[model samples]
Target: MQQGSQKIYFFLAMTAVLWGGNPVAVKGMLGEMSPTMIVLLRFLGISMILLFFMFYKYGKAALPPRKHVPTLILMGFTGVGLNNGLQFTGLQYSSAVNCSLVAALSPAVTAVLAVVFLHEKLKLRQWLGILISFLGVIYLIAHGSLEVIKNLSFNRGDILFLASQISWAIYSVLGRGVMEDLSPMATTAWAGVAGTFFMVIAVLYQGTGVTFQLSNFAWLSMAYMIIGSGILAFNWWNEGVSSVGPNRTAIFSNVIPVAGMILSVAFLQEHIGWREIVGGLWIITGVYLATRRSSMEPQTT
Candidate 1:
């Protein structure tokens, strides 16, 4: 039990580190790659790596069942293509700290979706948790002042980030049952293939010309987002979820913002003011209280 607990911590910590650095890396790439192209390249890279591993382990590249194929295609678009495209778009408008911290509201968003769509019941404490989490989000969105939100004086990047969260929530709700039918690796691979179509559309729509002379540093950042966050962090998160439980494992997601906060400041030189500190605290605490009761729920997001 102790060993498993330690492993969960390790896996979750690794998840925090990689995911933490993900936005910082993406923000750095904004100037080098167009948003859709970044999404396209990420899907392509992850698809290849996952397919290779799947074949090596199982000696066959198993595909999603026919019944699940259509749904998986949708997941691929929403989860990777759209999610990443908006993420990069929002990064163009917002600070890395704001983006990462706003994403921390995902579990809270998932809880609400559960209550509404899944028709799940919650205790009084859970409702309170939801309220508190939203309050934190509101505060963060308002940037420590209710006046800004009231006057609609928010950054375009922050709004895009919130939209990205919705995209992620949709993916979470839909990706749940798909994971039941396919291995995590297979599901991700198929989705990446599906997302490639959208990436092509984005490129053609934007009339992006091929730029092959990207600096080595830009390529390195893209590779980290592809390999580090997409592959390693994903598997580590799944390992943690399997060893502990989704509810317990989900707590580590809070660490992602903390790590992001540090790296954003250290590397990106983004400022972390009062709103982020206070808002992040409430969001993290609310998630803990809301999900304190464990179930066999899959942490899809």
Candidate 2:
């Protein structure tokens, strides 16, 4: 590979690795901070930085047109607001390993959503992929037990994670329309601001405003969330996309759950067993099958 290509790959790989650590970092913070507080503060900082970048890029155009305001707010609410809220709260009850493994199903979920909302038809391969991915999530939630399904018993954390993914999928679908009017970074910045508004209400309602007395570890985790996962990872992923195209950049995302599981086990002392291994593999394989562009599809240079 050319040196330039190699560098893009490195950044893409690092983006996945940093994203993999996101759940672990959030899980770590649960001990010292409330979920609402964490989401609020983390996104607030990220939003500010993104806003600065957007302004730099678009100047006065950074402010989205008035007609797009509601859509952006909805995107923020679903994508950032509800997504992170459910995720962090779920993490309070779920293992970071489980969170990461389940999260690997996002591409599949987004594909299914596209079928529903975008009127897109799926190929037989994509259908099979979606089915397999669904089964994988069911297996994880059931803890590899048919008896749990028979008894209607499921992990609440897993269910919330699933809900959170759906919320994020909605955001992604909604974003397709918004991106026609605004750049991705601008959409993210404005939506992040709107999401921060929602989180403020959430924090107020939860009555868990920041204590400003966080432990050293909590502060470190906060910095990682805002800077490492939020800003740096995002910028790197965008760089990969701009350099190598989204398909090539997307391939790097397959590394995220693997990294997350390993980091969870290594850092959080989380245990993983046959279920996580098997289910995670199923999710990754299914996502690849569902989202990969076929040879017949038009290719972007």
Candidate 3:
């Protein structure tokens, strides 16, 4: 039990690191690739890697049951297709800081969705935490200036990112059954493969030119997203969920924006204002409050 707990912590930490680095990696890829093209390549890389693992592990049984095909497709669409599509599209127009800050609200959104859709009950403290977290996000969006709202011009990208967050929350809520039934590796791999197919179609429709200039930073970025965030992060997160259970596992997601903020400052040399720091703290604290458990339910067999 002690060893398992340690492993879960390691997996969660690794997952946070990879996820935190994702915005920076995506930013690096943006110069040479369009958002649609980048997302397509990301899923392609994920699918290839996952498929190899599936074949090596379960061989033929790794292929999902025919009855599960629809569920897998839905998972792909919600988790990978729409979630990533909106995120990348948003990143094009918004600063990485904004994107990360918005994404930090995922726990709150997930909690609410779980209550509404999954029939889960939230304690009063959890509801307060969600409210506080949302307010922090709002402050971050406004950049300490309520006046900005008067002059606010909506960036298409920001709207897309918001949509992406909602998409991810829905995916997390709806995936409970699938997660209970399937191994994390199996679930992610199948969904990744299905998402790749959809991404290819989207890429073709967008008609964005794909390039492979090794000298460009875009290639490095693409590699990072594919190997680090796409494959390793998902695998680690799934392992963490398997070990710790999803509710507890989900708390680690709160660290992502913090990591993103630090990376943006260190690597991207982006400016961080006082409001951002304060707002980020509020969001993180709120998420912690929201995700804390009064008791653990028995693990599924």
Candidate 4:
């Protein structure tokens, strides 16, 4: 690979690594903070810094046109607001391992959504990949037990994580439309502003009193989310999308579940068994097959 391509790959891999720890970090902070509060604070901090950077780089151009504002807001609502809100809340009822396992389905969901909304063509291999991934999700959700499925005993957090993944897929599709008229930085920064706005509303409507009596570890986790995953990962992911398109960038997410499981086990002392291993392998394999470009397909980068 060329030097420039190497740098993009490095950043993309690091972004995946950062996001791999995301669920574990959120799990750590849940004891000290409500999910909504954590979402509010994280995006609030990220928005401020990113918006300032956008303004610094582009001046008034950082802000989208008035007509484009609504799309950006919607993007924020789905991607940042609903995505993190649901995921963090779900983490309360689910293990970080489960959270990462569900999240591994993101690219598959995005691919299917692209077919419906963007009118993109799906190859036979991609369709098979999606099916295999869906099966993996079912296996994980059912805990590899027929009784869990028959009795309808499902982990609430996993269900919520699935919802969050759908929300993020919608956000990814919607962002393509907005990016036609704006730079990725502008889209990401303004989306952060809009997401932060929606999160503030969610916090107020939930009517829970915010508390700051958090331990040092909670503070550290919050900082990591705000800076590492929120800002850096988001930016780097967008940069990768801009550089090599979403398909290539998304394949990097295959690293997340692996990293998440390890971190969850190491830091949170969570257990992972055959179910997570098998399901996660299926998911990672499916995502790879679904997103990888064929030799006959034209390359953009």
Poorest 10 consecutive residues by lDDT, candidate 3: 292-301
For residues 1-301, what per-residue lDDT tens digits would candidate 3 score against the true structure? Answer: 9997987787798889788888888876677677777777888887888889888987897787777778888878878889988898777787777778778888888899998988988889899889988888777777777776567854567667678888888877767777667777777778877887888788889886666664557777878888888788887887776677776787788889888988888888888899889888888888888887766545532
Q: Estimate each model's TM-score.
A: 0.93, 0.96, 0.91, 0.96
Best by lDDT: 4
Query: Over the full model, what C-alpha lDDT does candidate 2 score relative to the true structure?
Result: 0.88
Model 1 TM-score is 0.93
Can you list the residue pairs that collide in candidate 3?
none
Residue-pair clashes per candidate: 0, 0, 0, 0
In order, what is each prediction's RMSD in angstroms? 2.6, 1.4, 2.3, 1.4
Q: Please, what is the whole-model Cα lDDT of each candidate in the order they appear?
A: 0.82, 0.88, 0.80, 0.89
Tens-digit per-residue lDDT, 1-301, candidate 2: 5999999899889989998999999998898888889999999999999998878877897899898899999998998999999988999888999888888888889888998999988899988988888899999989999999999889889998999999999998998898888877788888999999999998888888568888888899989999999989988887787788877777777899999999999999999999999998888888888878877886553
Better of 3 and 4 by TM-score: 4
lDDT of 1 by residue, 1-301 (tens): 8987897798789888889888899888878888888888887888888888787887643756799988888887788777788878999988888888888878777777777877878888888887887788778878888789789998888788878887777778877788887867687788888888878888999998768688887899988988899888888888877778777788888888889889999989999888799988887788677767745444543
lDDT of 2 at 108: 83
